[model samples]
Target: MTLRADAVGHAFDGEPVFSNVSLAVDPGEVVAVIGPSGAGKTTLLRFLALFERPDEGTVSFDGTDVWDAPESDRLGLRRRVGIVFQEAGLFDADVARNVEYGLRVRRPWSERLGDELAGLLGRNGTNGAVREALDLVGLADDADRSAASLSGGEAQRVSFARAVAYEPDVLLLDEPTSDLDPRNTAVIEDAVDRACDRGIGAVLATHDMNQARRVADRVAVLLDGGVIEVGPAERVFGSPDDERARKFVAGELVY
Candidate 1:
């Protein structure tokens, strides 16, 4: 599935966050939204993930304008997208349990019912997706640890593992690796690659130009309350058509 925003605009109270920003992420593609602080990257991701409604324009899933559709349709669209915030908003549970909760919520009701029945029938009921997800995030050994006990990087990795366990159609990651060490950063990047390989589109919002360069297939530059440029990663970083984008990527522009 694809997630695209067309002329989308949003604001907080009386102040505008962004306006007329258009961007798209195709299946198996990784799109990066890069800008300085207060550029509304997180707000845009929230709208695309179906958590926040846009004030204008549309955020579409595949060919369907989810916001224009019914509330039920909006919920369905939300089920197909996973979001990781700048903060790791994990539940008060152990690592394995947290990941399992993420997976269980996204499963079909029939499958979940079957698992419940299997438990009553004394069956294992699971195929180890949670363990595999933890392993992917390099937190296999910390499965029994509480979320409160994890370090900053470890908590972030656990959050990533939780969101990725169900393999949603789109991943909305907001500064996912901002506080991570290099090793932990690679773990998250590799997990993103694995998900993209399975035809899951990903939107990574970050101010880190190098991180965008390392992970993006396409790049969208948000500035002055709008997307100033959108193009292939090479073109956006190497030779952008927009002057603001050019200076922003070159580190010569100050916010």
Candidate 2:
């Protein structure tokens, strides 16, 4: 599957935030969106996530234009896309329940059946999927812990687990590890790698150039709400054709 943004533009309250921005994420590919703060990286990710309809152009998933589709189709499409915001955004529940929230809401009957089957089989059963996600983030033992009791890093891990448990076709991440320490950041980065390993496309918005180098197959540089450079990570960072992108990559330019 492919998630694509075709010449997307957006404005707010008569003020334009960005225009004519286009990018695509192929299945199993990790695309890093790097830019200065206020350059509309989050806005662009919002558009790609189908959270907002762009004022111009379209966001498509698997060859279907999301905005023009029927409501049911849009909803169904959204179910296959997951988003992880900068904040952990966990509910006031235990870790396991928080991880289960998406599946419970989107697949209520299946969730119930999974629980029932798990109990009958004296195992986690399909709900073991939740445990699997927790395990991915190294939180398998924290499943019964109260989310409110979690540290910031743990909360973020739970949030990631929640998103991954659903096995979305596309994962949209907005500065997911910005607030994390090196250890926590490494954990989150590993989770992202696992997602891509499973053929889930990822679009990560981050200011960490090191992260882009480590994780991205391709990089798109956003400047003044437009994409100024886009190509393989090596070329974009090592030999960018755009002067602005070069400065940004060299740390000579501040956002």
lDDT of 2 at 52: 83
lDDT of 2 at 58: 89
Residues 68-101, candidate 1, lDDT per residue (tens digit)? 7998777778889988877888889888888877
Residue 21 C-alpha lDDT in model 1:
90
lDDT of each: 0.87, 0.89
Off by over 4 Å in 1: 108-127
Top model by lDDT, which number?
A: 2
TM-score of each: 0.93, 0.93
What is the Å distance of residue 156 in model 2 from its true position?
0.4
Flag clash pairs in model 1: none
* Number of backbone clashes in candidate 2: 0
**RMSD, one per candidate, in order:** 2.0, 2.5
